[model samples]
Target chain A: MSEQPTHHGDRPGSPPDGRPDGRPDSRAGGSSAEQPAVTASPSRPATSYRTLRLGAGPEWSSGQLALGAVSTGGAALFLVALYFAAGGFDLIWWLLVLVPVLTLSMAGSGMSLGFWALMLYGWFLLTDSGSFTWWSLPAAAGLLVSHAATALSASMPPAGQLASAAVHRWGRLIGIAFSAAAVVCCAAAAIHGRSLGLGPAAYVIGLVGLAAGVWLVRTNPPSQPH
Target chain B: MVSQRRRTTTERSLGDWHPTAAHARAVILASVCGVAAVLGRRPDLLVIAAPLAVAAGWGHLARPRAAVTGRAALGDATLREGGVTTLVVHADPPVRQADGVVTLASTAWVERKPASGIARLDDDGVAVLGLRSLRWGRHRVGTLSLTLTSAWGAFRVGPTDLPDLDICALPLPSAFDTSAPTPHPRGIVGQNRSSHPGSGTEFNTIRRFHPGDRLRRIHWPVSLRTGDLHVTSTFSDEDAHVFLLVDAYSDLGPREGIDGRPTSLDVTVRAAGAISEHFLRANDRLSLRTVGAADVAPIGVGSGNHHLRRVLDTLASIAPATERRDEGEHAIRGVDPMALCLVLSPLIEPTMVALAHTLASRGLTVIVVDTFPEHLVANPANVHESLAWRIRLLSRAAQVHSLTSRGVPVVPWRGPGSLDHVLRDIARRASAPRMSRR
Candidate 1:
């Protein structure tokens, strides 16, 4: 909780050391031997700065750092790939992926970034081919739209509304739909396959997504913070 | 009064120091880079350039003539802890932009809240920001740094200082005190010998004098039965006036201590504020004293809203001494005799104990409200000044007991419901009764 305006570093006043963060002087607030009962916040801290720091105390966990690294790394790597390939060089492409990658990169604690990453990569797969096959074009567009919708938990059209939906079940349903579509697309490619480079790499990554869907159903991390 | 007026001047004011011209140049360069990126179809260049542009634009927006006829308007100059306050920014020939930092000269905690509004030169050139809430005492919102620029971040000029802004934040009534002991003595004659008046305490009812009764207990009721005079004897509930002294030495604790940076002074301040309010509510005039240098007169003999305000302001501004081994010697050196002097402190020295005991011997009531300093524990391995700490605490505790044995009921103030009741009930039953909360 927050405290009153009068700030001493400790309950009794402050530390003898100039280090504001150091331990208090001897006999600071009779606070030894027992953890004081959590004092209720007198009031929300004078809400000044928009951002807050959850100090570098024990409260900061390694998991958070791990999440940030994973997110920023993923975005930077994919962005580099797209930049190096440098297709039509459309500025609009920046706008397309900007919201997802940037938002994901900035606030690293969420599944929202993962969903966007999936959609961006799906679009990248189709666009790089430079050939608009009837199946491929629709599949790419649907892939982006459905993935983004699932991420945002949105209902797009008149047919999309389904009341009484459970949050986890709804996510699983969407995953199954994507899995079906992916399996069909892969099967179609095999039927008239272009036996070429990086094709094997695409198949492997595709199987990974399919395997992840099953794992996600088994281990459900809550969408909200504990 | 005119002679008393100190000419307010700032030799190192924001007005005198404008940011170097180089800060503005950075903005121009960043903007040029933005244009280059757009022309060259380089999206990556644009990303790197935008933040730079914003930073540069910020400088440009901030730069302006530092000069202004600044008049600061504030909501309620006095504030209690956690009470909301507002500061209105106004300038003549209007500053193109209004922004500055608020520094509290005499407080443990205070903050300048975010504010936004438009200041049109053609219109009312005013901006308002909420100070929201503050901790305690009169504080000067001295020379705020202001940088003026157009809203667009196009052309920043120079930095100016907001002038003539000072405020007083009153101490708030605190509800947290978790350090009182229980099952206090009852039917007791407290340290203060002089009782206010009538009581139904330990003293028993008078009995009619019998023929063989002791001459000391010959009641008038019995005398009337036999048409003879008689003497009555019984104890009177004699309670005393308690003076709660708080050691306001600096270096007591952190500004924001383990408890949300609540300084040691903050705790002492809160304790003083709460106890004063409590005593005042109990129909007693409380005398507040802060030890160390810059000593102020103990809050005079008084009880009312005005008295509380005075105590709060005094407590709010109290700072710990920068020196070592000091107590309330200067503040209460020759103070009025206290019935019950409730001293709230860590008992940091033998002097504090000597002071309490000396007061108690004079038949002035003294109750030591210990501000527990033992909470400042940490590993000695990494600490530099680890030696000579533990020895100090033991000597101080001994000092407190010395006074307690002399009849001053030195009680450690623990907080919360039942214990507080016991302390209050015991005090009221004795002398230091508190006003019941409505």
Candidate 2:
């Protein structure tokens, strides 16, 4: 039993003679004179027992580091594909790449949404309109990979190892999500260089099409991979 | 066989699931990109936004609405020093798609497995964390907090805290044995030899057989040689009372647990336990009284395994330096007069030395077992502390010398055979005749 920090009469602030107060020391006398009149109290309160904060913060497990790498790598791949597709680089592009890498630990936050929006805005502004590029397919894949990896990384603690079952399940879900992107990319390519020429109704039709896409995406049930 | 003991708590509600930051991020990005793609007439943008839309939709659709509840349990509530146990945390109605992480806080004298104290729940929502108790005493195991994240990290349940569990760690007694007899053997049913002759295993002498002597004790060879009836006489077996007076005024040295160097209190408690176990096993009645620690209740004279457990429990309950004003009057008030008194202390406090002198003055056989840990002064943190220890030790030596001058033996604790020589000498002195003035 180590000397736990004690309260009451035995505290360090007690008199030098080992007495609680400035009372006279009677221990030098016979045993009969040594007894002191003091009120008995409980040794310590129940709430005093508390956990100790030891060591530094927990280190990231290998699984967590791997997920983080994948997230950063996917975001970088997307930026590189976008740069090549646009055939130019800007100062904002460098900032966009740095944001994802720097905020990789906060992948679960709204910062992820903000970064994705900026990346999409860059692609829209830089790429030629009314033209389909093969780079779009790989760039879409990169963006989806980044999103999936960030979500997975945020699901567990830094020290928590990713279970093989969970890894497999997430992999399958990413595949399904990317397959949707592939389908959309193929449809967009098929309609390249063609115009239906529906006139003023195209705006109303596009609005209806956007609403339908939201509904279709929102109503789709998640799969159980286990 | 040692049966396993477990304590399980009732399930507690963790409230309803809420959307995680990931879910909000996905839904917002997907919605904004979809509208932008349609308005800007960029089909390529729509293709890039497709995956985000799918992820947001799938996560929303798969979000579990049922409220979650969690419970934690311990594999064993009591353990010996250096014993290992398991803590299991469970989330009711296991969510297969959700990722669960259980974190156990770091506590004193407890070594957690995986070093991080974090364990992941399997498909059944069960997480097991290993706990190894390093010292003996009543200890509260670390608090366990559980967190659950829904599929695709869309939603989360909680980082809900569970109730803390308690473990009673019993001290591991050091090896101790004594072949010498106690000073006063006054009761029946023990292995000690009494002065009066009677039927026993220890032979006394051959004597003329009395009418009540059993035939089995008759010495036939002696009877034939003398042509008279003779019997083999033996000393009667009797039990003695052993009283243990423990000093808990201060616990010196670092608390390194059972695996490391012991503090003064650690040495005292374990030595008391070893002594109790030894005497109790020999069928001698034993009593335990603690001076400084108020929490420890005095254990009365008893024998057998049950009494040993009671003794150890009392020793385990010692909280050092709790009662600074203790005069040891209550501890020694009604002690058995003939009981062999063994005072276990570090002799750092004047109160214990006074108590020892008082007990010896009452004509009781008192032996002070010095429990001062040598490692305390071995490598002091500074020269001042080292000098302080040197001065204290000199004073302590004077106290020991005073006790010895009064015919009370002060012995330093060394695991086995520590008290054998002193006990043998005490027994011899007890048997010797003494002259007194008429």
- Which candidate wins on TM-score? 2
Model 2 lDDT, residue B237, Cα: 90
DockQ of each: 0.02, 0.17
lDDT of 2: 0.76
TM-score of chain B of 2: 0.91
Pick out the ten consecutive residues of candidate 1 chain B with the lowest summed lDDT. B114-123
* Model 2: colliding residue pairs: none
Give stretches of model 2 more than 4 Å off. A1-58, A195-226, B1-11, B196-200, B205-236, B380-383, B436-438
Q: After superposition, how far is residue B130 of candidate 1 from its true place, in Å?
A: 2.4
* Residue-level lDDT for B290 in candidate 1: 61
